[model samples]
Target: MSIIVQNISKSYNKAKAVEAITFEVKEGELFGLIGPDGAGKTTIFRILTTLLLANEGSAIVAGFDVIKDYKAIRDSVGYMPGKFSLYQDLSVEENLTFFATIFGTTIEENYDLIKDIYIQIEPFKTRRAGVLSGGMKQKLALCCALIHKPKVLFLDEPTTGVDPVSRKEFWEMLKRLQQKGITILVSTPYMDEAALCDRIALLQKGSILKIDSPENIIKNYDKVIYDVRTQNMHQLILDLKNYPSQYSVYAFGEYIHYIDKSAGFNPKDLAAYLEKNKHSEIEINISRPTIEDVFMDL
Candidate 1:
């Protein structure tokens, strides 16, 4: 394993941020920590990267203990924090040079590793970091993180606020980096991006709800799901939640996804109930499970 975490836990002022979480990343694998804000993903990443000490358990990166061999672990890992923390006053090239210097290396020495990504933003090398666009800033951050040729790259919500096109481009860059045998551990709230990972751990409230490949997770969803749409969306959600025979009901995009409490509940019966309640233009259809559905189920 390039990255191994065993029963790691962390807390803040009596509030548990990470609750004995455990997982591993194989060599060259693009493993993802998928969850929403406050799901403990960032805390776990910090523990593994040696930025913060775990209140309990152990984490190893590149065969170095995160606590005992903090320096070695730090030397081997590249961490891009959730927030953009690069020196805003420095130029793109200067930022890269600064990180390289910290790692006792030069940009020219590791240029080959980040050349593909760096070239995209190379024209703006002289531009101040704070003046760059969100997407460009992301690229420059990535380039600095890679300049030292670290064995593992830890990206915390690397695509949070970028444009959709830039987000797509970033993931493409990740794929290319993975091809070069760099193990990537990234966290993101986007369920769609979960499918892009080799394997994902779905987290919620400082606990992991599920861990598996996206295909397997979807395949294992045993609930009967229905996508319901009606003109009265707000009322429909409330009504569905209050419906005696409903097991689970929540809004998903343009529809309210729901599951029945019993196997024999019929869709026509639901429509009839809605009609009697004066809900017009109701449409409910059986639908396939998505990552968001799995999260909602948890």
Candidate 2:
């Protein structure tokens, strides 16, 4: 295992931040911690990177104990915090050099590791990091984290505020990095991005709901799903919740995805019933389960 977290737990002033979380990341795997804000993804990343010690259990990264080999772990792991933390006043190249120097290395020494990513923003090397655009800042932060050529990279919501194109570009860069034998552990709240990972852990309220590859996770969905679209979407949602024979219902994009309590429930009958209730332009269709749907079901 490139990363192993065994029953790790962390608390703050008697409140549990992470409760006995356990997961493993294989070498060269792009593992994702998928969850919404305040789901303890940051806490787990901190503990794994040795920034904070766990109150219970243990964690090992790249064969080094997080606590006992704190320095070693620090040297072997590259961490990009959720917030951009590079020096604002420093130029792009200056910030990269500073981080390299702190790690007892030089930008030239490990230039190849981040060369591809850095070159994209090289024209802006002289620009102050503070004045750079959000996408540029994100790339600079990633390049700095990778300057030392760490074995494992922990990216905490690296695409949070980036543009969609930049987000897609970033994932492509990560795919190339993984090809070079770097284990990547990334966390994001975006369900769409979850499908890009080799495996994902769905977290909610500081607890893991499920862990598996995206395909397997969706394939394992045991409920029948239906997409119901009507002219009165808002009112349709309200009506569906109160409708008989509903297992669960929630608004999904332009349609409301619902699950019936029993397999025998007839879709036509349900539509007819809604039409009788004065619902117009009602269209209902069965759809494949998505990661978002699975999250809701969980």
Candidate 3:
């Protein structure tokens, strides 16, 4: 495994950020730390990258201890924090050069590694980091992080706030990097992106609810789920929740995803009830389980 975390925990004052959770990522695997904000994903990345000390437990990254081998860990890993920390005042080319210098290397040395990502932003190499678009800044940050040619890359919510097109482009870049055999550990709140990972740890409230391949996780969702649509979504949710036979009901995308407490669930019965309640254009049907559904079930 490229990253191994065992019973690691971290806390601030009295609030525990991470609680004795354990998981591993095989080398060269595109692993995702799946969770929303305050779910302890960032804390785990910090410990593995040797930025923060864990209050308890231990971790290893790239064959080095996080504590005893802190320096080596720092040297072998590229960490792109949730927030952009690159020098904003500097131009794109200058920023990359500076980071390379700090790592005792130059852009020419790793040009082949970052060429694909850099080419998209090369025309704006002279532009200051602050003036670039959200996507451009993302690419530059990735370039700097890879300038050192580290074996492992840690990206914390790299797609948040990015435009849909840019987010798609950025993920494509990650796939290319993975092909080059660099291990990636990424964290994100976007459930749709979870399907792209080889394996994921579903973190919530500082604990892991499950860890498995995206397919396995969704396949293991045993609920009798349905996609429901009606004239008024808001009122329908309230009405469904109040219904004596409803188990779980929440709006998902353009459809309301629901489950029934009644074992002998019948979609026709639900449609009839809604129709009787004056809900026109009602649409209710069974749907496949998605990563989001699995996460909610967890």
Candidate 4:
């Protein structure tokens, strides 16, 4: 394992942020921590990168203990925080150069490591870090983190506010990086992005719900799901929640995903039930389980 965490826990003042957390990331693998906000992903990142200490348990990164070998871990791992933490006053090139220099290396030495991503914003290299667009800033941040050519990389929600095009490009860059044997651990709130990782740990409120390959997670989902929509979405949810057959009901995109407690559920019965509730254009269809469904089920 490139990264090993065993029953790690952290607390702020009195409230616990992450509790009894444990997971591992293999060398050259892309592992994702998937969940919504306040899930303790950032807290775990801080602990693993040696920026913060855990009240209990232990963590090892790149063959070094987080507590006993923090300096070595810092030298061997690249960390891109959830929020942009680079010098905002520095230009893109200047920021990259500064990081490379501080690491006792020149940009030319690690040019190949960041060539693909840096090229995207090379024209804006002279632009101040604070003034660049969200996507450009993300690319520059990634470049700066990779400038040191570390063995392990930790990216904290790197594409949260980025555009779709840039987000796609960013994942592509990660795929390329893995080829060079750099282990990557990333966290994101978007359930859709879970599929991009080699394996993912579904996190919520500081607890891990599941950890497996994306396909395996979906395959293990035992519920028969349905995509349901009605003329009045709000009323439809209320009626469904009260329905005796409902196992779970949650909004997904333009429709609501419904799982019934009854195995022999019939669509016609649901349609009729909605009609009685004064809902129009009621639509219900069998649907596949997604990463979000897996998270919600747990």
Task: Give each model's whole-structure lDDT.
Answer: 0.93, 0.94, 0.92, 0.93
Q: Model 4 segments beyond 4 Å from truth? A: none
lDDT of 1 by residue, 20-40 (tens): 898989999999999999999
Candidate 2 displacement at residue 65 in angstroms = 0.6
The local distance difference test score of model 2 is: 0.94
Better of 1 and 4 by TM-score: 4
Error of 1 at 99 (Å): 1.4
Residue pairs in collision within model 4:
none
Query: Could you give candidate 2's per-residue lDDT for residues 167-256 as a string of tens digits?
Result: 999999999999999999999999999999999999987889999999999998989999999888888888888888899999888889
lDDT (0-100) at residue 142 of candidate 1?
95
Q: Please give the distance, in angstroms, between residue 270's alpha carbon in candidate 1 and its true position after superposition.
A: 0.6
Q: List where candidate 3 sits over 4 angstroms from the true fold.
A: none
lDDT of 3: 0.92
Which has the better lDDT: candidate 1, or candidate 4? 4
TM-score of 3: 0.98
Candidate 2: segments with Cα more than 4 A from true spot:
none
Worst 10 residues of 1 by lDDT: 45-54
Tens digits of lDDT, candidate 4, 218-284 = 9988889999999899988899998888999999999999999997889899899899889999889
In model 1, residue pairs whose N, Cα or C atoms come closer than 3 Å (at least 3 residues apart or on different chains), thus clashing, are: none
Residue-wise C-alpha lDDT for candidate 3, range 1-298, written one tens digit per residue: 8988899999999999999989988999999989989999988988888889999999989999999999998899999999999999999999999999999999999999999999999999999999999999999999999999999999999999999999999999999999999999999999999999999989999999999999999887889888999889988888788777998888899998999988888888888888877888998888898988888877
